[model samples]
Target: MKKSIYAAMLSGIVCPGSGQIWLGKKLLGWGFISVSVVCILVIMDQIISRAQVIAEQILAGNIGNDLTSIYAAVSNVALDASNSTMPALTWIFIVNWGLSVASAFWFGAQQDKQLQLQADSKTEA
Candidate 1:
């Protein structure tokens, strides 16, 4: 029920930086979102490029048109490290998400503490 919990869940389950946005930290949230989006785009670009290569092979008759042949080609392409930058991108994406979640939770907790202090001061007055 705490804002910190909600913020963390938003970032972890919804998307990176979503929690920061919920916590009114627009700039930080956007930074996390931008990094995540860029990583995703780059990864997708690599995948599409590999798909194109497979398609070309199919067209050139080097790969069969059957489902099994297509699967084999896809597997080969995915495992071909020389043709992909996915390994590093995947790690970056994961680390970004983790940082976003942690920051959102920390910011949310800080906000909650401030609110509590304000409330206590008002009660003392």
Candidate 2:
């Protein structure tokens, strides 16, 4: 029982659906992993685009002597999305994480119940 809970916690915290996969649900775990990968890619794209823009600004003019200040300037407006994607992406990430945690606890509980039932059956026999 404790082992299952801990397994769920470790995997869920690491990759949300990973706990489910560890518990024997490959498809569910892979789905969660894929969505997470997509989210990471999207976030990385945003960061890279912002970095490119900052690099362009640096090259176009004498905007700074300190690179740190330039980084700060770039970071401030890095979240300016072309559309309403930032909020959606944020929600997707949150929902995925929440789902993962919930699934972990649920699977752990199911495992505990199964073990209890098996032990009871053995005692009766």
lDDT measured at residue 14 in model 2 versus the true structure, 0 to 100:
80
lDDT (10s digit) by residue, model 1, range 3-122: 899999999999999999999999999999999999999999888888998999999999999999999989987788684468888999999999999999999999899989999999
**Pairs that clash in candidate 1:** none
TM-scores of all models?
0.94, 0.84
Overall local distance difference test of candidate 2: 0.76
Task: List candidate 2 segments past 4 Å from native.
Answer: 1-4, 67-72, 79-83
Estimate, for each residue in 1-125, the C-alpha lDDT of model 2 and write its tens digit.
Answer: 46467656856668878887877877987888888889878977876887777777778774574878796777666655665776788789878877877777787778878988999999999
Candidate 1 least-lDDT 10 residues:
76-85
Model 1 segments more than 4 A misplaced: none
Error of 1 at 79 (Å): 0.8
